[model samples]
Target: MRIVWFRQDLRCQDHPALSEAAQKGEVLPLYILNDTHPGKWVMGEASRLWLHHSLKALSDSFNGHLAFYKGDPLNILPQLIKETGAEGVYWNRCYEPWAITRDKKLKEHLKKEGLDVQSFNGSLLWEPWETTKGDGTPYKVFTPFYKTSCLKGEPPRTPLPKPTLTCAPLPPSSLTLNAIDLLPKKPWGKEVFSGWEPGEAGAEKRWEIFLKEGLKGYKVGRDLPAQAHVSRLSPHLHFGEISPHQLWADVSKIEEGHDTNHFLSELGWREFSHNLLYHFPSLPEKNLQEKFDRFQWKKDPKLLKAWQTGHTGYPFVDAGMRELYATGYMHNRMRMVVGSFLVKNLLLHWHEGEAWFWDCLFDADLANNSASWQWIGGCGADAAPYFRIFNPITQGEKFDPQGDYTRKYVPELAKLSDKYLFRPWEAPEEILEQAGIVLGKDYPLPIVDLKASREEALAAFERIKEK
Candidate 1:
């Protein structure tokens, strides 16, 4: 008998570990929720909510055969093995630091007990160690790493077909999904997940929608937050509801074009992030470029709170934050805008922005989240130059020229004209009165002056420049 463990790789389609285990013999599919995370990166509130529904979807696919348990795998796995008298355990790999440590110990202990153990790369299109610089060293920049990632022969063996399996009966005393309580205690989940369907079917539906409609103009529209051009695939991908290989295969079959090339390049960014995290485990906390250590970051809780709650007075940044708080997802361009605001405009630490996203984003990921924040923080490999500050006003006018995105989330600014929508502070007092927006009364004033803050941020950057 074999017990197949489901970690991030949630779906049965294109699952190598699930395939291998089913071919072996009777398979018991398991998803375990440990009391604690592999590290302090606990599943965020949004993630917990998403996990609950995704697990339900996975369970339904198995016809109520998927098992849920909350405890240390050290305690849970052995019981599962004993319950089924399973001689082998299988799972896909998780590359986070804590998962690495735990998996290492578990594999050794299981092998010593005379049980066969196997793991596969069911998540990534390429393993972290698969691509490297000519010197066999890890890459610090994206362009070189992206090129090296593509040269590795044909794409990942056409994502394996969904293998059939015989569901084994639970031994006994199995916990129900609700018993694990992955959902938040309040009623907040209903709204947070209203726009999403969290499961394999949902993931596929989203992909189809993207391919049919969104993919055509993705390059131009992806940056525009108001449109539906972007595939809301990050949460699904993070949870492994869909395999990267499946995405790659479907995309590969499409005739090459700017849309195809640009989208695939984004996938390469995903690969780059996993590679970055594997080599630099401290990515979530430390600066990749050490000089950032000398940079002075602020600790103003009020500023942090204002930024977190979407009252920074920058329409683009506020809209992104409100979108995130509303849907647990934010547009990619907006993520950078908000990130730059926090780390640069507010002079807060990147980790502060990183930690906030960790708690709020439905797609809160270890590799992507950490690497992305560090990249914006200007302390990551191939990071943005510290001087390349993103002016929210220009960004809004360029990407959301009609002010549609700002109005969508920051509805208070809805009645303002496109000319003054992004810069409400610059709106003549008559316009504010006409729009029913009494600046300091209806919406808080700008938390900090952009001109002064930009200067201060530049001075801070200059202090660390010589280092």
Candidate 2:
């Protein structure tokens, strides 16, 4: 028998390790919740909730034979090997710095014991090492990285067909799903996960829906928060319910256009983020550009709390934060708007935003989250310049012109006119009363004066630049 360990890859389709193990002999599917290895980067509550549903679905696909265990995999795998009499262990790779360290140790130890141990690339379209510059250095800028290396290089592998499996019976010692305790004790999950379906089947359904409905106007419409131009596949992709290879293959079959090219480039960005993380493992905690170490980041807990709870008084910013808190997902445009607000307008540390998103977002990946936060903070490779702070009111006016996206999340402003929807503070007293709202009562006053805060942020950037 061969042991197929399930990590981020939860699907039966396009699963490399599971396919290989099934080809060899009877496969014992196993999942270990190694909470100790990740240290500060432990899986977040929202992600854990998703995993519960996902695991249940995957187990069902295996006819209820999937085994679950918690604690160190190094300890658990050996015991599983003894019990199942498995000759080999196989799993796909994880790219987090801590995961890399843990996997290296585990692989060496397993090999020392003379067991067949192998890993596969089931997640990424291109391995991090596969797409470096001619001199063997990793690309720092995204455009050159995508165009020069990825687009100019060999295409990603065509997706594999799901392999047939001769399954092993469940071991008696396997823990029940509830015993894993992946769901939060807080009573928030039912509503947050209402529209979400978290499994391979669900991933297929979502991909089909996006291809039919969202892919046509994607190039221009993605920037508009009110439009349904996005795939909404991040959480599924992160959990490996669907593989990038599958997406790449499916999209490649379409007649090429700006929409198809742009959509593919977004995937390229995901690859770029992973490349940055693998090459610069300090990405989650430290600034990629060292000069940012001298930068003065603020420490106002009150502002942080306000930002977290979506009471920031900037409708665009508040809407984004509240959307995240309520749904475990936020629109990408909103992510940038709110990220800019936190790190620039509020002048708080990017780490603060990164940590919060890590806990809250269903798709909160270490590479994407850390790299994005640093990009917004102007401290990452190919980062947005510090002076280009997003003006929340202007951003709302531009992207959510009809206020459809903002009003849905910030319902207090639902009755206000487009004229005053984004800038309620500018509304006359009578206009406010007509909307059945009062400033600082039904809704908050502006958290900070935008012009003043922009100047302050620019001055702060100048201080660091001078140093």
Candidate 3:
């Protein structure tokens, strides 16, 4: 019997490991909720909720043959091996640093124990080390990295039809979902559960909708927070509930025409991020550019709290933060705006903001999250130059011209006209009074002087550059 240890690659369809394991022998499907790295920020609550739903969905599809385990895999798998007398183990790869270390040790130990072990590239369209410059070094900048990846075309095809028979008798599993403790005791999951449906089927449906309807308008409307033109598939993608190769294949079916290149490039950006993470394992914590270490960053708890709670008083910033709090996902444009507000307006460490996003975002991926935060803070590979500080009000006016999304999330400014919604502080005293808007009380006053803050942040960047 073979053990198919499911990690990030959660689904069976288009899963190379699942296909290979099934072909070799009877397979025992397993998902271990190992929390050994709990203090290392194991995974966010929103992601755990999504995983629960996705696992439930997979269980349903496999007729409850899927088994759940908890604690360290190296310890648990050996015990299972003895119990089932399984001959070998198979799994897809995870690129996170901890996962990489864990897999290395596990594979070596299993090999010594005389068990067959194998892994496949299931998450990304290309492995991180696969594409490099002439010197065989990974591409540091996204544009060139994207160009090279595009030239490589899609990943080699490895489609697996759904299994026709049950994989072993589930090994008389001693494990249960409650043992994993993935669910919270409180009601925090209520909102997340109601909003997001997690599972392979849900992910497939989302992909189909995106390719058929959203991809065409993605370039133009992806920036509009009010519209659902974006895929909103990040959580699924992040958790390995879906694969980039599968998504690339499906999207490729659309001929190379209007917006097709735009959509594919965005997916390519995701691929590049994974590639970055694979090459630089410290991506979640280290600044890609070492010079950024000299830059002075604020450690203001009050400002961070205000930013976290969405009371920053800057309407655009507040709206974006509140949108993230209310929903685990934020629009891509709003993500940029909110990140700029945190790093530039508050002058806090980009790492600080990155840590917070790591806690809150359902799609808090190591590559995209870390790379994007550094990009906004002007300390990443191929980053926006340090001088480009986003004007919150102007950003709101440009991306959210209608203020419809702001009205929905930041209801304190609801009664105010869209014209002043982005900059409510500019409204006359009488107008503010009529809207029940006590600027400092109901909503926050702008936390920092936008122009002054921008200059200060720029000066700080200059200091780092000089160093």
> Judged by lDDT, which candidate is best?
2
TM-score of model 1 relative to the true fold?
0.98
Q: What does candidate 3's lDDT look like per residue over 1-467, in tens digits? A: 88888877778787878888888878888899988853476777766767777788887877888888888997999999999999999999988878888899999999999999999888877777777776888887888888765556455465557665547777766576656777756576677544566888888888888777788788889988998789999988887778777777777677787577787788888877777788887777778889987878889999999999898888888888888877888899998888888888788988888887887788888788987888888888788887887888998899888888888889989988877898888999999988889888888788889989988888888788786
lDDT of 3: 0.82
Q: Candidate 2 overall Cα lDDT vs. reference? A: 0.92
Query: What's the TM-score of each model vs. the native?
Result: 0.98, 0.99, 0.96
- Model 1 lDDT on a 0 to 1 scale: 0.89
Worst 10 residues of 2 by lDDT: 32-41
Ranking by TM-score: 2, 1, 3
What is the lDDT of every predicted structure here? 0.89, 0.92, 0.82
Clashes of 3: 0
**C-alpha positional error of residue 61 in candidate 3 after TM-score superposition, expressed in Å:** 1.5
TM-score for candidate 2: 0.99
| Candidate 1, run of 10 with poorest lDDT | 148-157
